[model samples]
Target: MCKKVFILFAIFSFLLFSVVMGNWQVAPSSAEYEYSAGDSFTVALTLNGDGNDIDALGFDLTYPGSLLNFRRAYFEGTLLDSWMFKQTQLLSEGVLRIAGFTISGAINSGTAGKLINLVFEVKATASDEGYIFPNSFTDDLAGATGDTAIFRVKPLGYSVIGYIWYFSNHLPVPNVSISLANYLNTTSTSGEFSFDLIPEGDYVIKPEKINDIGGSVSPFDASYILRYAVGLTQLSPSQLIAGDVSGNGSVSPFDASYILQYSVGLIESFPVSRDWFFLPSEFPLDDANWNSAPDSISLSPLDSDTSGLDFKGIVMGDVTGNWNGGLKKQTAAFVSYRIEAPHQLSQTKIEIPLKLNFNQATLAWLVKVRYQAVGSKFLSAEVLGKSENCIFVSHEKNGIINLAFASPEPLGNQQIMVSLYFEKENSLSDKFPKIEICKARLNETLAQIINLRENDEFQASSFQLLQNYPNPFNPETLIEFSLKKQGYTTLQIYNTAGQLIKTLISGPMDAGNHQSLWDGRDEIGNLVASGIYFYKLKSAEFHLVKKMLLVR
Candidate 1:
């Protein structure tokens, strides 16, 4: 009876001690992993002791047999480094058994650390699921003797995705270079980019692209920068970089001046060395050193599949953010205007006045003039009258003239804005010079140029009446005609039914080209309804009629 009681008491003590010790578990460094086929990787086996000392530990690890090739096991820099006995074996095609024990002393209580490292190489592609699992765990620790510990291993791949866009319009910028470590990718036409099979770690991403810096820089951009300098507006971080055309690390009115000069071709390049700049979409605008921050992006400790790593692209002088990779669309249609030069076939030098006929006020304008005739030299140009308040710049090169002007205050209407002087070679006396306005801007909208001629193409002996400008009129239109000799002229507007509505001119005129403005009205000044109408020019030697339309 005493032997029976002793054995039962010992068994009870062992069961109580086991209940107090709890279970010991071994797990991988990460619960999940990502790798492509033919890529090599490492997995660390860590020991987690539940306040229990361990002298020996062993486990059977199972992996995807067909997809992974087992390399070798490492035990350096681990809790079992001083173990007297350590062994690792490939028990089966996909099963590895590893064990280690220290005979020198106990591994110590509450010791939790890495036990071994398992190396592997992916052989084939497979669906995402459990790739490595602890099939069995055993340890020579008191109390946790037959308890099963849960173990899991997942292998989900990782990717980095992002987009690039224009800072001004938020339009996609394609073909931009995006880099991650040693990997590189170019954005698609949709401005989307991605890098697959990336490992989990810290990285810095960068973007780069270079393009012709023409047509994207304009006076509007300078105006935007000026507004920002005066605290009248705000600009994004990327926009600030674009506004720093002088490369002085800050934006100022002087930068605006430089940008304006570049827009008008007064300066061939910006003081900034680059034609384009970029910033991460997630860049902190409120950072104290944001103005001096690097252009690249940082992904500190990227540990998962990351996305939405977008970037903003800026043209160096496009502070208003209106660059669309040189494919900008017009905001408004072109409105045609004419500038007539004085008929001078006898002089070798002449001054042409650039008079604009408009009732509305203008804040900015840019005009590009091209001289079609050879040997005609443009001497100088100057702003006159109210236009003198504007910042004006003009550059003439290779028979092309670029004029850019901006005013803080509105320029009044119906005035001569500039005067251009030119000298012609006497050898080309018989051939008339033709001046064409290649491009023109009034405010922010594009304007059309019509009838940029010295005089009418007809002979001096013939009387002529030209068609009215903007034949489909609104509330006004211009009537132009030429007289072979001085005489009394009557220009009358009549209804389509041949009844006279109003007489625009009834007086003696000189023998030259003439123009008259016809407001859409009757003789009493009442606005007429929308319809087709005719105008007749009757003189002693010329009689002609033309049709026009007016829409209210």
Candidate 2:
């Protein structure tokens, strides 16, 4: 009986070995796997046989050329005695060994019929054309089988991509969709996708998504943005101030405005997509009044009483600019007026001592003027009464009305010269009337400010992305570029096959000239192959793609 029992035990041990043996097996899920060029993946590893525990079991991964890359590795077990294992074989310094692995007893230990798993990951080459990389494993113990996983990388090429965070503060949206149309072509999967082969043509990228639910559809965020990947010849001005319809750097507002004119056609640049812009809160300006129209009150240098002439409580009509009065004295007239708070300017008579040539004069009408703030705020007055300029604030304390009735040459129109010396000594003492231009005419005032704008055009000092002096970039390359505004940006590298080979920076950056260096490897420290490569710049609104050659 003793002999028979021993035989059974021996047989059982052999069978267990057989089960765990025979070339370690993988999911076989896809003999070949395709992945996002710039994305990372996590996959599971399985063994065919069942064994409580297998000792002296490990894997050795090798890399042929600087082409393939390795990042990290892990070993799964159920041992209570925690221990960290150092990496024995590494292709390059880039290989990160995740050591010191100790599994809790919750799992089966050696001698049990449980399976153990070893996980690992590797990065792809930095080239456009996909490279076939094979991951092979070798088990020290004879019973376990060796396994390998294959991967194929995709590329993003000249297409630049970005996302818009569009969510309403009021509602809870489970899943949101941000889509793009028009000049920017996009393809999305359940997961991430890549954009490649973009031309230099201008395009409009607007966000379109469903809100709350599919049934409750709404417009995209007002502050939509686009990810741009400019290719080859970088657009002179890295930014498109207004009409960046294509989202690329070019003054293509003409395209956007044209699309607006052709209402019959599909609206390409309208803010309708999610990825095109951020939520409304992302807007940087003051929310004071993006919708309301200000009130406009008419003023005739003729009416001088506070009774019927006191225009208040009425909203202003859009101020219409009148050139009939000549450019020298252009007038913007409003129909309604509202008294901004209640305050009155001191009634006084003002006169001009000196007669001078006139260049420009702006006249406004209002109800009551606060006297507290003189030069800072506007002061109101009645017109045409005993005080030729009664409503007008007279700064001159003594010389209110210097009436010199002498020259008959300019006689028909009483040579009434008004002067006020209040601005010099009491700079901030005088109050200016609050003139709310017609809501419709608000744009006119803003335009006037523009017409008076000083030339502040920016000239980007450099254009071409200067290559790192020495051809085979040793450790790094000093990259330099200039920007007008600070924004989130990304600098990356891609191989000929269009795959994302490396990422130099991925974060919001400030405006002004910038310089970054690439160590010629990918996110993984593995060295890259020598060849023609491309680098791209991405921002909330700027996308530029430039090429570089890496000679191995």
Candidate 3:
């Protein structure tokens, strides 16, 4: 009997305490708001409960005078499906009333949930002097008998005001977009993106539209140096793995190089090995780095800076090299093209000559030709006549043509040469028949740029080592050869015993027809009795020796 009495007393005391002090209290007790006269904002009504079931609710509210004009009331996924009474109306000129209740029985909104969303616009003349906006929400009064068995509710709200701005180069960025939860906004010309009304919930904001998408391995300014350090990259290890341009199992340096090559149309396959982590299936390599981890000011490595400043955007400070940043050119080569519509007819034939100046033997070469494609132009490129040294030639899409050449033997620098010929992309009666070699790669690096405008009078067809005019001469003779493009060129005269007699020409020469008069003398300028002599012309991919008679 004594134990039962003690338990009963304890229960009674707990119930009395529960009835005396409600378990919930509206949070953030107070807040303030300020905005421009034309700005509109939302006020979110929040309900926090003490882990109790709330079947129904009733609330009354009063607001500041003429400061805010109620626009709309909206809520989704709420506990109350039916409203017995709901409204926002002016009780008096400066005071507004909001009253609402739930119809059906017990609903549990434990801890927190949005009870209501109200949009309000400040009057054109509204000022920050008094900005006391929304009313204190109150809920407690019940039905006729006052049944408090279900839920004790608490209300909370916050003041929404000024927005955030995104700027670059000391100017506001316009049309940049960002969103949080259910709120979305676009930046104005002033670079300000605003969300006037929003629920106070845990939110993850997403940003977009700052710069053109571009490379990985971003070149860092002073700020990003810390952000992209080896172990401290702003990018996660996963993101760094995505920076692996070749998908070679690590975020290697080659990724940056591959990005730049892809941008310029040097490689057909994107990233050459498609395994990017972020939105891989959606974006291309054109402006790829913009997808993540670049830009100096943002300081956020996870978010990408889609601008032209990305490391992958550009590379090779001084040399022409492949994505490995290897295969740099010590010197440049030149190229030129000739197009002729014979007799002013569409029977156009195009030719391009090449000049390569290098010390090492060229292993391989790749060139891309872009043309103003006309009817049958694609057909013309594939079937165009080329030299026997060319191993492969094919037409790629979009008026691009790929030509490649490789030699089993080491073709010395001064022995490298190439020529291309095809019917012009234009048809019969076409005014401008156009095609140009846009890019070239030797040993997989961009061929250094050099001008090969040797002969403006006539375009060349191929590398030609023309016979010496007046071969049997007393004093001198002229040796001629067609310089298709710029390259290391050399001319030598030899005796019948194969000993060098004189070196006539040894230097870089532009594309065109070149001629040199070789006097009948040795390197020492000594004239001797001559029998049979040979003159040799050597340039990139071209080597020829012609027999000549010298009578002295």
Best by lDDT: 1
Using lDDT, rank the candidates from best to worst. Answer: 1, 3, 2
Show model 3 residue runs off by greater than 4 Å: 1-127, 130-196, 200-354, 357-363, 366-403, 407-415, 419-449, 456-552
Best by TM-score: 1
lDDT of 2 by residue, 1-552 (tens): 999999999999988666655343323223455543445444333444344343334433332223234433444443322433334355353332122223333222333321323233334433322222223334333434434445554333244343322122121211223222333332232112223444333333332332222211111111111112223222211112222333343433343343243233455233412222222222332233322212121222211211221101100110111111011223342222222222332333222122221122223212111122223322222222223332343221121222111221222212223222212224343333222111111212211111111223323333334333234555445455666667788888899899998888889865654556666777544578878888888776667887777766
Model 1 lDDT, residue 176, Cα: 86
Backbone steric clashes in candidate 2, count:
61
Clashes of 1: 2
Query: Model 3 has how many clashing residue pairs?
Result: 26
Tell me each candidate's TM-score.
Answer: 0.41, 0.22, 0.25
Name the lDDT value of residue 152 in candidate 1.
27
Each candidate structure's count of clashing pairs: 2, 61, 26
